[model samples]
Target: MPHDHPMTVDAMLKQEFWEALYQRDDRIWSGNVNVNLQTEVEGLKPGRALDLGCGEGGDAIWLARHGWTVDGADISTTALARAEAAGREAGVTVDWLHRDILSWRPEDAYDLVSAQYMHLPPALRRDVFTAAAAAIRPGGSLLVVGHSPKAMRQFDGQKPPEELFFEPEEITGYLGDAWQWLVETCETRGEGHHTDAVYRARRLEA
Candidate 1:
């Protein structure tokens, strides 16, 4: 069993925290897609995509390389800068934005809007999840990811214990009648560092 520790968002976003975490020689969380994200989104064609909480730009950069016009957003300037540098190095163009998603407003609709591993307090999670669902154009999709309930004990990083993790049913509850569920599942990855519930839903045409 892991040590019981207090968890908070403020504790998670300390300066140089995530950068130091990702900049390691091994690329522990470097911007790469593990099995979960790729398997779920493999059929998605390159198009307008919003990568929320896009740390180090791995997934966003990958989408761009595959032909998506991606806007990668993160609250960390350091992470965004590193992602920009990585994009340049990879010869891919990705728009990096340093903004908090809590206050972010969509200027235009997108074909795909993704929030991977965004663990917000209950209220904020609902707000953003709803907003993301609404931000999709007709026939567009919303992809949300968060650690699974079982992940609490296994994955050791920042997120609260599995008790605080939201399940796919909880997420679908938020969608209500606005969108149709395309996919939803809970899985483990990353040598036990990641246990996540993935949600993929498409807005129904009016």
Candidate 2:
């Protein structure tokens, strides 16, 4: 099952490609919050949330339903439109922003900023993750999850690019002294040999 490639240059071309991908199907993802996300946030009190690369808005909707006001950001307009409709159907409201994560800058910090499975070029990913960590309010959390490098060997057919895969530390290392690590680990999923690197950290109170 091919997934949408990470954003590239040629802004218009990238948007059209992703839009077509989303329009080709009724849904692109499982339409449920990521297990890692669910596990990490299950105990935290709801607050202002930002779902980066929210695609189809699953995480955003989940956050909203759980009492957090959510802002879902994605590059594809079609995906955002579908997410908005899904939010309405789910009886929760999400502020959908049509923007690329690479260029997006939040006007305000969030209590929870999540970027799940957001695969981008190394430099761009580092920049975005750094900015995301910086956007967490004091005593808030930042969760970053992505495909582990081991997945390249585990799923030979997929052959994802090296730059797209990373270890939990690659993300967590971007955090400065302001953050406290809560969880940093990698685990394999059943059967497919799929692996995910998860990093959840809290911004220390200033």
Candidate 3:
């Protein structure tokens, strides 16, 4: 009966992996805005922001404090709970939605949509990133950061699946001609070994 569950096997695996990780620690990610996100967003005017795969609300809280109305979404209920608590602790309000990025459909466009280190199987990654792109309002910005394929060697003994890695182009290429690329590059961090592919683009007015 378990094997014949309603959810697809891939969905089950994705949930299991993230849930187990969240359970293993009080927090799986640092309670700080990702460096790339902070850097990329520093100059942009704040507005309605959507944070995809937002783990623990660090970035969302940061955006809220900087005058943006933030909506943070993640698949893991545990992570969403922590994110809500973090938002409270920061004295900022973030709309925390427990939803998988791969299947999410935004009801409204946002001035900024950010997905930091949102790695998934290639198919899922393309789908979610494309959707995120589409959710950006004209003249709005989209920022995506992911583990670059080059970082695979930095995993020590517990290497992630190769398919979870992506190049910046893979994400940027998903956008249509309406987007103007801003930042597209890879950068190393943390002992100069862990590299991330960072992409930032702005949608043109129709």
TM-score on alpha carbons, each prediction: 0.80, 0.86, 0.86
Give the total clashing residue pairs for model 3: 0
Q: lDDT: which is higher, 1 or 3?
A: 3
After superposition of all CA atoms, the RMSD between model 3 and the true structure is 4.5
Worst 10-residue lDDT window for candidate 2 reads 4-13
Best-fitting candidate, scored by lDDT: 2
Cα displacement (angstroms), candidate 3, residue 142, comes to 0.8
**Per-residue lDDT over 69-108 for candidate 2, one digit per residue giving the tens place of the 0 to 100 score:** 9999999998999899999999999999998778777878
Query: Which runs in model 3 stand beyond 4 Å of their true positions?
Result: 1-13, 153-156, 178-192
A best-first ranking of the candidates according to their TM-score comes to 3, 2, 1
| Tens digits of per-residue lDDT for model 3, 102-122 | 787887899999999887887
Query: Could you tell me the lDDT of residue 82 within candidate 3?
Result: 95
